[model samples]
Target: MRIDPALRALRSNPDSQRIAQTALETCKSGWRSAEGNASIFAELIRYGRGDELGECPALSSLFADLDRAAALVEDLVSQILPQIAAHPLGQVPFRHQYSGGMAVLQLAAAGDAALSLVMYERSGDTPHSPTICFTDTERHEIALAGSGTMQIVRRNRGRRAPAELSVSSVEMKSGQNLSLCGMFETKRIESVEERLVILRLGRTGAAPEPSLEFRVADGELVHQASGDKRDSCHELMVSLLGRMGRCDAAPVLAEMTRSGSDHLRWQALRECLALDTATGFTALCGIARNPADTLSANAGSLRAQLIEAYPELAAFEKTLCLA
Candidate 1:
């Protein structure tokens, strides 16, 4: 799996949007289990319209569940919406409409996906609104225009109780391949050792590269080459060198010159400078003059750059310079 592409797409969106999408997906997938339903419901309701409640049977049963779901949805929406709406990327639309004595709220997405949110309200001396929120994930497409409606009624029982009902209707004519709507925030990168483990376990995916890049970025070449527990990193590197070649690990190659192990240092010396005018030339020069190793590859550009900056290599420039 090429995780980098997905990571790139997610980075294009706000971190909060990603997190909220992740939370919403987790809730839908039943990862939170029954105990988490209430919190999920509250989050769905917070930005949702009071009249949109009828779309979900769970929301309608809020009273039976002590309105726990409603409260959770409300809290989540309240906490997340301000940040999501305030994001500078694009605007998310929320519209409120009233018809036949009922109020409806609809949400529209202006960026990648088309979304609708609904709320319902009943009229009387005291009116109540119920809300529900939803995203279209099954079609793997973007919604162009979607709408939601809610209905509310007043009942004259002995107690004069009020009854509320709402329905959210969505029609998506067009769609885009989007990461699950609620999955933006839940993605995480694993450690280098863990990545090696996964690679060894045959989990061939792009998820490991970023982690490996981090190790190189932090100047942890020894850690990258030598696996934490076993010689796995070494074996992996050797295999990758044979198949993908050393240049493929350019970032890592750049750091190998400073590696603790002599073997790694030599490997870096040979491989890091193999490609003409590669980025790792500076490190290659240090290895060439170490006396323990011979400079087989040409290093003219390396010497030129070094002489211009350090001037001390001027005398030995002829031998070190690539032909």
Candidate 2:
């Protein structure tokens, strides 16, 4: 097979490669300059704190000021686009691609909060996905260009037993803004006309509840994932200890079972029972007997299941009666 002339030329472009490398170094230097727009925004968020802003209100206030936000985005765009053009081979530091035909580029971050640029290209061949997932975070977004419709779904705060939800749709256009509290509400781009660009500020902190995904048709929960990194780490440690057969860690696991998030408590209790049956059974019984505890019903059901699977565990119930 004969080699294509265009391909052969591309393979031997040392002069172009050298020029591209010089352009990339220049772009990097400008981006990291002390007096650059990125540095100003970074310092603004880190004013009263260390490298990270400890309070969410600071970021919230910045995002709420529409005029200031617009100016910041304009300044960032003026710097970012030229950098991209100069160095096409370079990639943004933080870029996240969404399953719904969107991309987010994080421009600056301080602690749990971050400023990001969101972009979606209009595509008729590969349409955007309808599925939506909600995280336990606070978000504020300002549209810089294009137009779309945003669909907001909120769980009714008044209802407890069965999850009740309400839906609302708002027209999104250039210069418009929206704030969403993901603790109870979620937003999705219902439709986009042409291309859409947005400036978004997000703050994700420790939340008591997990992030949730729901089926749009039936409004039923499809999946849930933990939002707390610390709790997840603890659960992982407890499981490791159990798998290692570290009987000495039983006391620590037992203590964890008495408090903390419902998910973590149950996980610790399970590991504790596996490592030290006596301590695990006692904690399980305590939780099951407490009507006020949130996991009482679950603990009771778990105890019954255990006894049915391992009849030897029935002896522990008799011991509980004697005690």
Which consecutive 10 residues in model 2 have the weakest lDDT in total?
47-56
How well does model 1 score by local distance difference test?
A: 0.36
Off by over 4 Å in 2: 1-67, 80-91, 95-100, 123-132, 236-251, 308-311, 317-323
- Stretches of candidate 1 exceeding 4 Å from the true structure: 1-232, 246-248, 275-277, 290-323
Clashing residue pair totals per candidate (backbone < 3 A): 31, 0
Q: In model 1, what is the error at residue 205, expressed in angstroms?
A: 33
Model 1: per-residue lDDT, tens digit, 43-101? 33432432233444653343234234334445446644654554433233345565643
Model 2 root-mean-square deviation: 5.7
TM-scores, all models, native as reference:
0.19, 0.71
